[model samples]
Target: MDYYKVNSKNLSLLKERVSVPTYDRTNVKAGILHIGIGGFHRAHEAFYTDELLNKNSNSNWGICGVALLSFDQRIYQTLKDQNGLYTLIVKELDGTLTKTIIGSIVDYLFAPENPIAVIERIANPEIKIITLTITEGGYNYNEATGEFEIENPSIQKDLKNPNDPKTVFGYLTQGLKLRKENNVSGCTIQSCDNIQGNGHVTKKMLLSYVKHAEPELVSWIESHVSFPNSMVDRITPATVSADMAALKETSGIEDAWPVVCEPFKQWVIEDDFIAGRPAWEKVGAQFVEDVVPYEKMKLSLLNAGHSVLGILGTLIGYSTIDEVVNDTVVSAFLEAYMEQEVIPTLGDLEGVDLNEYKKSLLQRFGNIYIKDQVDRICSESSAKIPKFMLPTVQSQLKDGGSIELAAFVIASWAIYSLGVDENGTKIPIKDAVKAVLHEKAVAAKSNPKAFLDIESIFGSLADSESFVEVFTKSYQNIMQFGVKKCLIDLNSKF
Candidate 1:
């Protein structure tokens, strides 16, 4: 059971079954500085970059990862200890596994350790492209208003002291200012986050923050900086102890922080980089002129499909996505939801076949080896539902299409927020607005319409009598009959 710990010193000790980086990690220069080094980043972006390094002679696209929040301390320490090297375990559908040591990330900076060092690295002329994988909430923008939250306490603190900045906005502003002072050419700011129009949103939020800090820098940023929208997809679950154990047993590499994900990976980016970028397209990435259609497709189907399964599966006592999809009724329901409700919302997509995409989605979700947890998908329903699911609901309502499935999904979420399942097992509610959902969900036990009144979440859909009727009916069905009976009856309808 003795295994070499995953680090620079242990690379030579790795088993032949495991694939180590063929390129020289020591000579790699940090051309891409990535913020928010989460599991998704390690699995998706870093995986692509690793392949690029191995295939081509270009060593300039090495990633220098930054961990901004205090919460990232553990990951930072793990990466630092491993010399920015970690195992990527890809779980195949037939339970086969492929373990590779991802060496794209050569350097790491924990911002909390030294803010100035982080800023200086960003200001480095050699770091041609700065990428971000910060989650949707990390942007610090008002979603409803589409404006930066300037009154935020963190924003206030960052504005007052730009030198010792606390927020991404502050750090970026200071770094860009330093670059300008040093006469360095502007770099590309690419966002690998899941947000729709991520590049445009980043540019807007960053410029808004910078305008308040320094008005003179706005015009310069407009001309120099490039923000490329990207659509990134990978089912990378949180790395648990089991993943580490699996890596140790399968490859004899004792990695402290290994990433586990499904075999499928995708990235569709807008072809716009100011300074330069890696030839990622050589490694299964697509460069398009516009990423909006792809964004809309993925968010509507794949992302919303996760929400559908996550909410319903939790109530039905299913722990993982495969378990949810394996059930005949549940899988049928998902297929019907995509075919009747979701596909209609998306118009003609270039170079995409809707049927094939949906088929692929079903196969991906049912990959038993992945073990994508329902709880991971269920977390942050308050933020996720609005972005991924509700738009479909609104579209269905406008076009007078069937809204029963969408209503059922929302009702399931409302029931889930009640903190207990049908069998009286406590369901842990994980959301930023947990208290609000709990309060509203409790109030809805008596008045079913009360939960819909949160305009921030539901918007004008609450005012529609047809939606209220269907939603209330679905709510009553689940409360009176039970999850399985209600699901069967609902499935029969489609």
Candidate 2:
């Protein structure tokens, strides 16, 4: 129970006392190589792997985590200091909490110090799956084409010298080359990013690297590698002092690397793996033939809904999803937005009731205990917009439908680009177009096209007259009337 010490006894006590699920951690082999070792990956995929290990005594699905970015050294040291152990706290709406010690991670590799070593391990015949949580931006994609940016400096270096490239794609291609050279069959590359058709996107990126870097390897990867699309849902907020205090009170263990997430967790994976997979379904994972419809539903409705709350939440001076969801106006706006704008664009899918899904989404957003930060949800709007909002906008416009809500969301994004929140406090905007956006905002006065004109983010959609008119009108309204008033006007349209 000592705060400063972490040993097996304390870990076991914390798990037992907190009602954390303990897994049979011995028999699982290191088959999966995870690229990102961040909070969500630990709370979601790692948690799932832990459950699988607990159920199946002899599972072969342990994960070896690889950190590509420079900041990973601290994470590497933290996990290594604790002997590859960390606690995940799942907080519920009514103040209920459950803490679990995740042990599915068997090894760790820092890219800068041990890139080749990591690549070699990835090529191992026993390693049958390479999964990634490398975020939407980490793929080094060309914003205009949504393909892997081949001219990326890291990628260029990798192509010039396959033995050493700092990028994830570079490491992956190198590993695949090793696999081919050693006659070891290729592994399934499962992309867990929030992008729609994540697997296909990952394939395109990887194959793009292969085409120039290793053409022979490209053919083998095309034929052998299985890139399965997956929909991963979990609301994990950035850690705060309150979370640390809660962990201290509950676990009596001071965890420097503790992760706090909502009690709700969902993983819908396509049942496609080249070298086979674990019985993850036993651990409450949904396995289906095609994950596109489900992915679209979740991405457009749930994720996009979160974006709506995030931007508007910050603008309204709310700190968390729970806070924003409780505001009557915000809550009603989201409900109307989803029902009118998002749902109509979605095609029906088997085993999914759209109405029920919307209801559940509202409930999840209202779970006050989750404390999901608006800044966290709103950070990567540039990457997220295309996936979560654009498809719906395009569909609605093509059908000559009203896009009041969607347009408002775009206007909010432009407002966000102004670099100030409701209280006149500056909110840090992180995007590839941050500098240009700030300049444009200075000149254009919260004009939506100012941000959209960054052709990389919107592609040719920026030039569409219908989109321009709708978005421009919405932006002008928001600038004149503000978010709350704009919401009132949007509702009047219904």
Candidate 3:
């Protein structure tokens, strides 16, 4: 027999590999308009929604996936080509693989091509919730001023042509403007980004953006809209053509774009939707009053562990996260840092075990099949630090807790940001502020204090004498003694 296709013809063949959606996708209503439909979105939110749709008959929540930026070209075209049907493969530590054909995405639009269509879709009374997964750097943030960059090129363009907006902020504000004009009800804007106070930050950024773009629309939005903070977690790696081939080989289904992730997934959402929402809680999703405890734990421990392994892994000559976490020294450093420095700053949960979570993170990072690239993990050092590790550092510094390991992680990034590893090979820096990082990194080699001068990443930490001393010493030590020796020595502190 020939290979199975993802369409209706090969349902029997596909059944062995994936749990295909049985519900009539045509009957599903577009209740959520999700922006930034990337791999993370497909694996996390789409997976959750797929479950809810499959289990419940009364749910009307189908996602209208929208690609807002130019970088989403590959995914936009792929999803369009596949008719929004793709395979998700969850890889386990023991080599057990489970596949699911997700069908929650009923429609998709590349917003850059037709911004007006996207805005109009957003204004639809049926779209009760709008979600986002745009990275931290995507927001129009001015690190120096600590406000939304109201005059950003995109925002400026959107302001002049609010009817046909380009930016996500523009599309949303204008969509709300249209909704207000039509006397439609307000919708929820839920942010799935890893930033702390994600909902609060989003509300502030949007309010700031709309203030400059549409002044009158601001007051109406303030009363009608809701910004719900969420904590989303899953270790979904970058899927190349190899992953697609793997799905084809294993399942005999030719999926254009396949998503591969760790077996673990988590979403803790604040139940604050302005419009009616999905009964996602019926299908393993946690609905809580406050997502702060879960968010802080995830960001501080898991994400911060990635930061440690990422920069240190590169400097120490490891390529992937598994390789980095497999190293006893790197793994030990992360565990110690979390228990002593990171965990101290997090709030205690009712039923969750913190130590088990930490251990599980190590196992997830050490998953052989995931093959999460350390360079990819460490790619955007400037952004990851402030979100994942800075909260812990800031909190630890205030309480006089152990920050030696945290200081070492930052020092490792400064050294790695120099664009050369310990082996004298060129390293690639892929940060939003790469130019500034490169400049300061080169200077920081001789004078580590210079790296801390990047106020956006480091803030006022450079001014503190004690922090300066610890960070400078660590950077110098890493440069002189190398990563393994420095980390091994740092572990001796505990």
Judging by lDDT against the true structure, name the best candidate: 1
Q: Write the per-residue lDDT of candidate 2 for residues 1-494, one digit (tens) a residue.
A: 56543444466666555544365555557888899999999999999888877765446789888888888898888777766678888887688887777888877888889778988988999899999998888777866788677777777787787777788888998899899999998789999889889998899988887888878888889888999999999888887888878788766867778888888888999999989887888888999888888889999999999999999988877888889988878888888988988888887788889999898888888887888888888887888887888888888988887677887787778888788986788887877667876776665574457667777777777778877887788878777777888777666766
- Better-scoring candidate (lDDT), 1 or 3: 1
Task: Give the distance in Å from residue 287's predicted Cα in candidate 3 to where it truly belongs.
Answer: 0.7
Q: State how far residue 444 of model 3 sits from its true place (Å).
A: 1.0
> 7-99 in candidate 1: lDDT tens per residue?
988887773558999999999999999999999999999999999999965899999999998899999999999999999999988898888
Error of 3 at 466 (Å): 0.3
Candidate 2 has a TM-score of: 0.95
Badly placed stretches (over 4 Å) of model 2 are 1-4, 7-9, 12-16, 19-27, 446-448
> How would you encode candidate 3's per-residue C-alpha lDDT over 1-494 as one tens digit per residue?
35776654555577766799878787898899999998899999999999989986556799999999887888888888777888889998898778899989989999888988898998999999999998877776765456788767878888898877778888988889889999999999999988877899899999998888788989898999999999999998888788888777776889878888999999999999988789888888899998888888888888889888988988878889999999998888889998899888876787789999988998899999899888788877787888888878889889998888899989888888888889987887788889999899899967899999999777898988888999999988888899999988878877
TM-score for predicted model 3 compared with the true structure? 0.97
Off by over 4 Å in 1: none
lDDT of 3: 0.87
TM of each candidate vs. truth: 0.97, 0.95, 0.97
